[model samples]
Target chain A: MKSTLDSKNLPILLPVLAFSLVLMIWELMVRVGCWSTDVFPEPLRVIISMGELISDGTLFKHVISSLFRVTIGFYLAIALGIPLGMLLGRREIVKHLFNPVIQFLRPISPLAWIPLSMLWFGIGDKPAVFLIFLSSFFPLVVSTTAAVISINPVFFQVAANFNFNRLEVITKIIIPAILPSIFTALRISLGIAWLVVVAAEMIAVKSGLGYLILDSRNALRMDYVIDGMIVIGAIGLFIDFFMKRLGRIDSVFWASATR
Target chain B: MGHIVIENLRKEYSNRRHFSRSPGSNPAEYREIIRVLDDINLEFEDGEMVSILGPSGCGKSTLLRIIAGFDKATSGSIRIDQKEVKGPSPNHIFVFQHSALLPWMTVRQNVGLGLRNIEDKARMEEKIKEYIEMVELGGFEHHYPYQLSGGMQRRAELARAIAANPDVLFMDEPFTGLDFLTHMRSREETVNVHEYIGKTILFVTHDIDDALIMGDRIVVLGGKPSRVKMERTLHFPRPRDFEKYPELGKLRSEVFLMLGVPYAV
Candidate 1:
């Protein structure tokens, strides 16, 4: 399969070429009878604006602010969600008791909670972080619960045959068995958390990428607004990449093929 | 001493979806009880290997599960070594038909699971390697279950189960999905392990030849709500060639007829 020009390079080349085509089209739209650069910036103007933001270092500050919120909120959700999900998944009675309430709350949209969160935590990082937490918590719990329930029953039998106590059953059988699903759940929740952090920042705080975009629009610096959007998209891609790499850890490698 | 006595074991299951399907219908009409096993009584001598043969869904696996304490029998009792079976214990291990190795762990780690109680780390490692080698999985110790073939996975599971030092082993269709050569090879491997360990084992299989060739005693189950249709001690010795031994041939056809197969071919 290794010829003179490596066949493995084709997959990498294809995506790059496709993205370049998209950028050319974007530039063409601006060059032809499109709106002025201030109204809707071109790709080059966005890049120039990005360079200016980088030189001023405000971009880094905003990015870090957004990341900090995501980190705290995401960790909080994980710490609480996994244990509760496992408990609910293992015992049907507990699931039945609380699952309805959870289901009803899950679909309410974290955006709708903005007013309540602002009122409860007041406008600052606290409310923004709270909104991010709410965005991630429900999906994490739901996915973890489903993952635990979907585990192969034979592993439990194997656990029983070994005379596993409660702790051993959880650590040895349940945890390891549901690992792949847990990674998937983490990926999805992280995505939701990242998405909510932006919207939350726009409303409750003035130190994040979302605030940068809103502030730029008020000043009519449309180029800076476009730069903020570009940074958000780039960071979102990076988060997904990081999660995919995390899932490829040695423990979950066995599931990579099957999944 | 792993003698097991299963006395009049019976199992019944009501449809789990009955209530949801017809909520207001008569309870008796909606609740359909499926009888899986009925009045199964069997006794195994210490260190004997018993192969249980039956038609598909004849409750053969159900009976084995009950004996292993993975499932509750609707009624009856199972006594192992004079103690009544309550729930699954380390004294008995059941090898599933499908590969049940923990997907996240390597073969070495999987084998080490059964030896978790061993405090001496060196001894545990030694035992793990010994079992892995026993099943000819030594080179694949770091490989996961998905990385191995069907035969390798089964052997790995066998190593894991045997390393636990269970007194009674239950196998449900251990070679159902293997290719022809692997099936023959695994059956040989099972027979060898049985002779070496001399632990009482109860195995369920749909293959008649496996029972004839590998078991010290054979029990055939038939019909819905299955009952033991035939039980016999195979006195004809191992490596029993059908062409060479008239009695083996006679018994093979006899079993075929009993199982409702006309030609015996």
Candidate 2:
């Protein structure tokens, strides 16, 4: 167990060592007056600020609120996006009719939806969630549609030849074949959800990491601003990691991780 | 009663948008449905091995697909065992040219995929093993399609097709991609499997030698909008050796003549 732990620690040792080196240099530069402490806080000072915010429950409040908006928005996107994708994929008439509309909407940036979201849903978690949903829905629908449409016709024929009914064909052959791509789409959409929600919260909401960043800036606290930015980055990375783990467990996506 | 009949069966695939019309034809005729079969009629008895020999462009594959109900005829009736085949039936098993084994499934899983209703795990395993051994793929049961060589993949497909125990088996150029020795072995395996299973086999191939080796009756189809041109019945003993034929060259010349291939006898 000790040896296994050491082996795993070896991979992380380089990044940990590099982080320490950078921090030491940062401290030295500040002490030498090459860079002002006001402009860039030291690692120790940033850690203290982080700890204080956490201890005072401000950080948790913002994180929890952000998570709530993102989750609701993300779940809504998945529920609606997947079925729409499948419908458009399987039916030629639907694809021909809706493709132009989807193409027109896809190119517009999620940030561009902010004013409309505000106008439509009002300034609150509603607007933020709406923005995240818009951001997440496009990629999910497009990827899943492509996946569903591109299923090998031979697989369908095989199922039919075996007298497998329509439900069985979709549930057994079609779904399993497209699962890898669907998971991929979900991951991409989740990333978009996180990104667009942050931007939306900065303009549309009063609580969340994005709001916290603006609040810190207004109070002239650069350290808290930087701390909020770091928290956002960490959360994004953590979510992506968990999404990938889920993909590996649920789908035949061995290539994505292994390669 | 378990038989197939095709009468005046025709198919026409519409042209793509880019290739709208010929230079000689009217441009307003943007859509062109190229007829693949024209007034073709044929019948197969139950438990018969019939080989369809035709040129590459001929509609042998289309005919098989039509009979299997994989594709619909533009205008025709196909009765399998006196019932019109509207869609794919559980009675027929098709072995495609490329094996068509799902890459994610192992040999055993691929074979047992069609038998999902067989809830008894031991029986499924037994049937899978039985067919796998019949096609000489018992050792490779755990291997995926990608892991197997081309010849092995064909064997796996054969094993899977036979495992379903269908009343009719449709094999379309299943051994064409194999090396000569592998092809010979695979051909032997196909014959052996057919004999053991006693299933009605509709085997399609361009190779006359393959037809002679495995078919109880061979139908030669040729020309555009292909139709059955010639039918020859093979009355040789079971498990006949190909090495003992004295008039093999003459027989091949006749096949070439039937297929419009220029050959000197």
Candidate 3:
């Protein structure tokens, strides 16, 4: 029971300690009048600012908007990336045709697509979602393709000896053999998707944590900007934790085998 | 009813040219020359356990692979049960020297790999249980191959091979790396399984003791073309002892002579 309390106390404890340190330094500086509010706000003012954002519901709206964009883009990436990876993995001809194109596009930053995205789809959420998809797509596709092709040849021969047709060979043997690697790709892509969504929202017409940070900066609300950064960090951490849990469930056999 | 026939089998691996070396006066002489297996002819009968005993690079494993329908002969015909062998058969399975159990899968799943289409999950489970019991790996069914010891892994492979109920089981030096005592136990279990099912086995090994213990008849093969040097049939009854049959040592010397190896000191 004490251990459980210790574990539960961790989340509140570290932040509280860090907050206390920051507040002590800020209050000391403020008492000495070394810095003005415009330059560096006190910790108490930041807390009050956080409370105001929560009550106004603007913060909640931006958080939900960002979440919705990330979810859709991330799911789309998985849907498209997995099949594309399988194609590249299985067919030499297809891989050859697309290999150069993928190589050319992979290094282009997701943010670089903003201008072209706006020209193609107009502003609002489309550009943001597209940027997220672009960010997640390459890693997911490449990792899965590498995984599928890297499966042991012995397993392939075994499948052939079992009278497995092409479909059966792929579905029953190749997919299962490569599933662990594919799951690893999904986790990586999810992180990339979250990162890209924030970057996209900062530039292409806005309503997200990124926009809130920018807006607060323009309004001389440094406390609100800090709050937005905190929210982004907290959300990203939560999603990562959930992703790890989901990965464990999806790759139970793989996890146990590796262990 | 699978029978393998190899006639004038030839295999040659081409080597890449070296840019550092200038073209030779006789370019053909400079070409890489390796004739691993040349013009080999053989046949295997149904329900027979034939051991292919030879030194390294004698193409014994290659012959087994061709028989297993994994490799194609350069210019020879291989017929199984009088039908031309085109590719892998559903009723033929090859067991490598190393257990080669899929590391990701548990023993039970490895055993049931060939039976993926069996809609009746219970029946498949029962069959896996039966084979695991046969190899005395009942409690270790859920354990991965890597978790088990080397001997246990071979036993699991044996259970997997038998679970498929293949007509022809091809084993390529299945006990090569095992210690003497572990090798004996695994081979003993393999022999028991063979007795129970009566599947045609084409076993390849370099060990004479293994050939003597497990094979009903042994085919001694030699280097360069890998033709059969001699054939010996054991007339000893069940549970034969090596010490009691010192003749096996004499035979082993003769086989070693044919293989161009000196007899044991």
Ranking by DockQ: 1, 3, 2
lDDT of 3 at B199: 83
Q: What DockQ, between 0 and 1, does each candidate earn?
A: 0.76, 0.37, 0.41
Predicted candidate 3 versus true structure: per-residue lDDT over B24-141, tens digit per residue: 5566645675666777777777888888898887888988888788987777787777778888877888897666777767888888876766899999888889889998887998
Candidate that would win on lDDT: 1
Each candidate's TM vs. the true structure?
Answer: 0.94, 0.85, 0.89
Candidate fnat values, all: 0.89, 0.53, 0.44
Worst ten in a row by lDDT for model 2 chain A: A250-259
Please tell me which model should have the higher lDDT, number 1 or number 2: 1
> In model 3, which residue pairs have backbone atoms overlapping below 3 Å?
B3-B81, B38-B225
Tens-digit lDDT track of model 1 for B1-265:
7899999989999875535465676656666789988989999998989999988889899899889998999999999999999999988988998888888889999988889889999999999999999999989999988889999999999999999998999999999889999999999999889988889989999888888888889999998889999999987777667787787778788888888897677
- What lDDT score belongs to each candidate, Candidate 1 first? 0.90, 0.82, 0.82
User: lDDT by residue for model 1 over A151-207, one digit each (tens)?
Assistant: 888888888888889999999888887888899999989998989988998997889
lDDT of 3 by residue, A205-229 (tens): 6799889988888988899998898
Model 3 segments beyond 4 Å from truth?
A1-35, A247-259, B18-20, B23-33, B119-121
